[model samples]
Target: MKLKLIRQTGIHVILAAGGALMLLPVIWMIATSFKEPESIYAFPPEWLPHPFTWSNYVETLTRPGMAFLDFFRNSMTVTVLAMIGNIASSTVVAFAFARLRWRGRDALFVVLLTTMMLPQHVTMIPVFVLFKYLGWIDTYKPLVVPAFFGAPLYIFILRQFMLTLPRSLDEAARLDGAGNFTLLTRIMLPLSKPALATVAVFAFRAHWNDFMGPLIYLNSSEKFTLAIGLHMFHGQYGTEWGPMMAAATLTVLPMVILFLIAQRYFIQGMAMSGLKE
Candidate 1:
């Protein structure tokens, strides 16, 4: 009993230490955001600001040519469009893979999985060229349009989740005179809320934080998303640490709120999706 108690205590201590390590950066960022510029880099590295200031947030939000509200609106538009496209496309593709049987289905699945192994950089140039030819550059089309085709990872995840669902459900729908479209819409989609939420959350976050895509495709400053706006805050000679931290905090708020809202569904879908056939 004593030995077991000692081992448990040791495990708790290790876990606490690991938790602190993970939280340290977040703590530092918050601390720095509130500190005055003079005290930001003070010796001994203060964990809490001596005299906290809210000016950073105000300045960050009100900065010239950075229009926080506009950037936020752009981010939200892109995120919402991407989420809709991903959900619609992933659902149909995953349903096909999970419920429909055809020649070369397994081979096609293997090919889909193989694409995941290829680095995004390899295909980025070709994608850029295609978008350029279509006159999609300098517009949101490059970011929003591709999502309608479904992402390979999201399709795979939803397919895995769908596979775990009982075939009896599909049979019942079929007996009710439901065709493929009816079954997919009336049955599969309703039952796959958790998986769909997971896909939506992921796609929203991806497009929300995407800097490179927006930078390459959107030349107009007014159309820039939050990620691009953040990058522009850093000048060539010096960086505005306070405003930068404030903007970083603001940028993360939406993701945090979203995760808090959909975290349960996300975890549940991931857990159930791994069930073996």
Candidate 2:
């Protein structure tokens, strides 16, 4: 018993240390946001700001050409729309893959899975050309539309979770005159909350933090998302560390809140969807 406890304690200490190491940069960013610009690069680094100030945040928001609020709104628009599409499409496709037996279902699913192995870089140029030809350049459509087609990884996660559920529920529902759509809406969806929440969190984070997509698709400053807008902190002369950190802190806050709210479901989904072929 003592040995087991010791092993567990050691493991926990290691994990905690690793976690702290990972969080150091984030903690420093927050600290820097609070610090005055002059004190930022002080030798013998200050872990805590000597004198805290909201100036950085104020400057971040009020800075000319920054349009931080507009950038924020744009990011929220893309992230929320993309997240909704991903959840809806992924869940429906996953349900079909999990429950329905079609002639080529398994083979098609295999092909879908294979697509996951294809590097995004390989398709990026072709996708860009298609979007450009469609006159979607400088629009949010390129960033948000692909999500509605369902991401393979999200589909896989939801499908695996759905498969873990018993088919008896479907039979019982059908006996009560529940059709396919009815089964999905009433039974499968409710039971698959954990997996859905997992997908929601993933989708939100991906679209929220996506820099490359917005950079490639959006040409106008007014259409810039938070990720791309962050580059404004870098000027030809020097970097605005204080305001930049403040913006970054604000940028990260939503994802933090989201994860905190959905952590239970996220953890449950990950735990239950283990290694099922």
Candidate 3:
């Protein structure tokens, strides 16, 4: 009993130390956001500012050209739209792969999986050019449209989760004259909440922090999302570390809240996805 307790205590200490190391930067950012601009650069560095200045957040939200509200609205719209697209498309594709029997299904799945092996950086330029040709530049289309087609990773994850479910449920549904769509909506979706939540969380986070796609596609400042807008806080002469950190803290809050709310599902989905035939 003593040995087991010692082992568990050691594991927890390691985890606690790792967590603190990972969070140090975030903690520093938050702390710095509360410091006066001058104090932010103090030689010794202050872990806690004596006088906390909340004005950095106020300025960050109200600054011109930053258009923080517009950026927030735009990002929320894009993230929500992308989440819906990812969930709907991923669920449908996963259904086909998990339950349906079709010709060359496994081979086609292999091809789909192969696309995941290709680094996104390799295709980024080509995709940008394609979007430019389609006149999709300066629009949300580049950000939200492709999600409807389904991301290979999301599809694979959902498929794996679906595979872990009992086949008997699908068979039972079919015997009751339930169609594919009905089975998907009535049975699979309800049972796959964890997987769906996992996909939604990922999709939300991806587009929320997407700088490259927005930078390449959105030409106008008004159309810029939060990620791109935050970049403007850094001037060519000097960066506003205080306000920038303030803005970053605000930008991260939604994602943090979302993960906290859906964390259970995220872990459950990850576990289910690892189940094999």
Candidate 4:
């Protein structure tokens, strides 16, 4: 018992150390955001600010050429629309893959899963060419429209979770005159909240922090996302470390709060998703 206790204590200590190491960069970013610009590159870096200032945040938000508010609005618009599209499309496709029977369904699912193995870079240029031909270049359509088709990984997650549910629920609901749509809306949806929340958090984070997509497609300054706005801090001559960190902190804070709020559901969904076939 004493040896077991020692082993568990050692494991906890190792994990705590690792977690602190991982958090060091984030901690430094937050600390730097509060420091005055001149003191940012001090010989001995200050772990805590001598005089904490909100000016960095102010500058970031009100920077004349940045149009930070417009960037924020564009990000929110794209993220929310894409997230909704991902959830709606993924749920329907997942339901079909999970509950509904059809010829070649299992084979098609296997093919879909294999696509997950294909790296995004392989198809990036082709997808870009297609969107360009469709005149979607320099538009949010490149970022938002693809989401409406349903992502394979999200579909897999939802389908796996749904597969864990007993089919008896479907039969019982059908007996009560529930059709496929009714089964999904009334019976499956309520029970699958955890999985849905998991997908939502995933989708939100993906679109919110999506840099490459916006950088590729959005040509106008006003159409930039927070991720792109943060990048604008780097000029040809210098980098604005203070305001950049501030913007980064603000950008990351929402995702942190979101994950904290939905962490319970996220964990539960992940745990349950692969519990069955």
Per-prediction backbone clash count: 0, 0, 0, 0
Order the candidates by lDDT, highest first. Answer: 2, 4, 3, 1
lDDT of 3 at 171: 88
> Tens-digit lDDT track for model 4 on 52-133?
8989889888878787778878889999999999999999999999999999999999988888778898888999999999
lDDT of 2 by residue, 88-133 (tens): 9999999999998889999999999888778889889999999999
TM-score of model 1 (CA atoms): 0.92
Against the true structure, whose TM-score is highest?
A: 1
Deviation in Å, model 3, residue 25 alpha carbon: 0.5
Candidate number that wins on lDDT, 2 or 4: 2
Against the reference, the lDDT scores of all candidates come to: 0.84, 0.88, 0.86, 0.87
Give candidate 3 misplaced runs (Cα > 4 Å). 1-9, 235-237, 268-277
Q: What shift in Å separates residue 113 of candidate 3 from its native position after superposition?
A: 1.7
Question: For residues 1-277, what per-residue lDDT tens digits would candidate 3 score against the true structure?
Answer: 9999999999999999999999999899899889897789888898986588898889887877778889899999998998899889988999999999999999999998888778789889899899889999999999999999988878988898788899999889989999999999999989988778788777888889888888888879888788887776665214778888898888887878888898886676567546533
Model 4, TM vs. native: 0.92
Q: Estimate, for each residue in 43-125, the C-alpha lDDT of model 1 and write its tens digit.
A: 86778877999988998887788787788899999989988998899899989999999998999999888886778998899
Model 4 local distance difference test score? 0.87
Off by over 4 Å in 4: 1-9, 268-277
Provide TM-scores for the models.
0.92, 0.92, 0.91, 0.92
